[model samples]
Target chain A: MKIISSPLELKEYLKGENNSIGFQGSKSIGFVPTMGALHQGHISLIKKAKEQNELVVVSIFLNPTQFLKGEDLDKYPKKDEADKKICKLSGVDVLFFPHVEDIYGTDEVTLSAPNVRGYVLEGNSRPSHFNGVLTVVMKLLNIVTPTRAYFGKKDAQQLNLISLMVKQLFMNTQIVPVDTVRESDGLALSSRNVYLSSKERVEALKVSSSLRAASSMVGKNILDSKEIVKEMRKSLGDLEIFYVEVLNLDFEQLLHVEIGNTIILVEVRVGTTRLLDNIWL
Target chain B: MKIISSPLELKEYLKGENNSIGFQGSKSIGFVPTMGALHQGHISLIKKAKEQNELVVVSIFLNPTQFLKGEDLDKYPKKDEADKKICKLSGVDVLFFPHVEDIYGTDEVTLSAPNVRGYVLEGNSRPSHFNGVLTVVMKLLNIVTPTRAYFGKKDAQQLNLISLMVKQLFMNTQIVPVDTVRESDGLALSSRNVYLSSKERVEALKVSSSLRAASSMVGKNILDSKEIVKEMRKSLGDLEIFYVEVLNLDFEQLLHVEIGNTIILVEVRVGTTRLLDNIWL
Candidate 1:
């Protein structure tokens, strides 16, 4: 697998590959952008990307802009060598690892999240987080020019907002949402999971259990959002809940759950590490 | 020339053309986006676009977001039939004329101009104006996907901001600055020029003349920005000067003019109609 650090070089390399293929024989490129410290979730996304296209490109950029001042940007995990090995084993055609400076500059033009939709749920806890996610994603998308981009559904709101951006901006790439990869104990896999202590790791299971409870309530036709949220809170007992929300596919708050269009999202602090989990019903 | 109002249809049309040509045989597309009260200035941009690319697309969208509340959005000039004829005559391949609703939606993802660069001079007078301009331009650029996009230097700040956006966002389109087109008597062509009465029209000459005076001063090796600006203001006597300042190419205020990298910009109100002109030296 070819590893490129500069966006310009990566673009030039891709352009040359495209030119060599000729227009009629063009190949579809599938891309998976990540913040490194790869987990089962990221590998799942990469595997799905490899299945969908002739070539798969993975970008590992711990974009600083997405992290708020107090967020653990400085301590965010990095496993560069392991990530490279995983990319090679997963059959990635290219690995794009760009520096913070290469991806951002002074007085840059930025993408603002939709005021109403962008500031709810995860955005509520971490304001300006989605803006950073979107800005970096846009930069990556422009550089990669992929036929399809893969995003894990574990970050339901991020995935939703990204899909919205692609549609709203008329960007020329398909955003495919892969299902949330989970642990045997039902906890959603996250890079932040590494931050959890042994005791906190056990408590993190409450996040997934809460979603499972919400899913069971939906199965029993308890479609009212308030009742599901009430039961979800009970399942997540003693965990410091950030929020438990029932929203539509578009991220609009719902009065009641509508199957196949509703998402029951939960975020909780297990020790100092905040964990998120959701069920798309 | 084909005139398309739907962005989707235009995108599909372009995609079909791209596919038909095959990648290796693909032709370059040059684009000119405008607020459609097509005049000689718009024609010049179109003519330049035609000379550069095999396909030329001109979008006539009178974006309302750029206009502050109580501004002349409702009364902005519209000469649809004449504009169409002029485009056809100028050898434009496609004219994308989309409505406000076609381009915007509820709680949309937006582009914010850089705080320092965006809120000075023209931006100072029309706060949130560049945000709207950048947002729409981004949408149009994505929709058109042109190899090169053309902008006249008459709105030097706007052109500069647009170019900055393309670079900062890592957008693929090349932004080409065509020299500002002028009337026989040196009045810069603008759709707003129609708002000026016969008397105000003559007074508007001061706008361009101020830039010309600044240029002549630069030619004589008078690089002192303050001295040039003072004389330019004197030439404008009683014309309600908005801002008469010199700045570097990046729009940062300069203590003294640096030749080959300076822009002298002026804005003034003539009978309730705002006029702006600038020179890039």
Candidate 2:
């Protein structure tokens, strides 16, 4: 696998392989963006891209802008050597390990999340986070010029907003959302999962388990959104619950549950680390 | 030349082109966006693009979002068929004539202009105008994915904002500012010129001539910006002067004129129709 560091180098490298990646047969490109501490979750996304395209480009950018001042940006996991090994093992054609300057410049233009949609759920707690996520994603997409970009559903709202941006901006790239990869212990995989203390990691299971409990309630036909949220909150009793919303796939509040259209989401703090999990019914 | 009337159709066509037009070599895409009723100014932009790129695309969209509620959106000049004939004559490969629905959607994600830079001069008069202009230009640039986009310097503030958008947003396209195309009598060609009576059109010469006088002042080494504005205002004696200011290329106020680094801009009302003119020193 070829590892490219700078945007100019990546653009030059991708331009030569442009003809064999995506839909236009010879001139399409497939992109997969990750936050670097690659685990099975990122590997799963890479595997999907490898199956679908002739060339698969993966980006490992620990974006500083996405993390608020007091957030875990400084402590965010960085397994660069291990991450490179995984990319090579997973058949990633090129690994883009960009420096901070490679992605952001001084006096840069930025993206703003929609007022209503961007400030709900995850956005509610981490306000400017999505804007930073989107701005970097847009920069990466433009630089890569991918025909299909892979995003894991683990960051469900991030995936949704990126999809919305591509559609709204008329960006000529397809956003293929891969299913969230989870650990055998039912924990939805996250790069931030490393932040959990040993006991907190066990406690973090409640986030995913509560989501599973909500799914079971829907299976039993007790689909009242209020009742489901109430029950899930009860199940996640000791953990600090941020929200337990049973929203439609579009993140709109649902008065009545629609079987294939609903997402029961949970956000809770295990120790000091916040964890998120959801089930799309 | 193929004319695509709807944004959906244009998107479908773009999807087929994939990364070929933009990521591949030789054929560069040059774009010129206008609010129809194409005059020599718009024609000059198209002509310049034709010289620079292998494929030129011109979009005729009288974007409604740019006009305030009390402004003349209903009276915005639009001659679709004639615009098509002009594109055909100018060697435009594609004439994208998208309707409002093609560019904007219900409850859309949009681009906001810079708070400080956007809300000065024209933005001060039409408070939300630059917001609309930036939002639509973002949409158009994404849709066209042009190598270079053209704008006339007559709308100098608008040109500045668009260039800022491209740079700040990390957009790859270049913004080419063509000099203002003028008529034999020196009136800067504008579609809005249709609103002017013959006598008002003659009087509008004061807008450009004022800038000419300002240029003469600067040429003679009169360094004070205040003196330049005062003389330019005097040249437009009876016309309603909106603003006449000397500023550097970055739009920062200049205390003293510096050749090749200054732009003297003027705006005036000639019998109720507004006209803008500027000279880059």
Best by TM-score: 1
User: Model 2 chain A — which ten-residue stretch has the worst lDDT?
Assistant: A19-28
Colliding residue pairs in candidate 2: A18-A27, A19-A26, A19-A27, A20-A26, A22-A28, A109-B168, B260-B281
- N/CA/C clash count, model 2: 7
lDDT of 1: 0.91
Worst 10 residues of 2 chain B by lDDT: B17-26
Local error of candidate 1 at residue A239 (angstroms): 1.1
Candidate 1 local lDDT, residue A147: 95
Q: Candidate 1, residue B218: CA error in Å? A: 1.6
| Tens-digit per-residue lDDT, A54-87, candidate 1 | 8899999999999999889999998999999999
What lDDT does candidate 2 reach at residue A9?
83
lDDT of candidate 2 over A1-281, digit per residue (tens)? 99988888887877767644533435556789988999898888888888887789999999998998899988888899999999998998899999998777655446778888899989999999988998889889988888899998767888888988889888878999898888899999988888888888888888888888888888899889998988898889888988888788788998767999987888888877888888888
Candidate 2 runs further than 4 Å off = A19-27, B12-27, B197-203, B238-242
Model 1 clash pairs are: A23-B23, A260-A281
Q: Candidate 2: lDDT of A200? A: 89
Chain A agreement with the truth for model 1, given as TM-score: 0.98
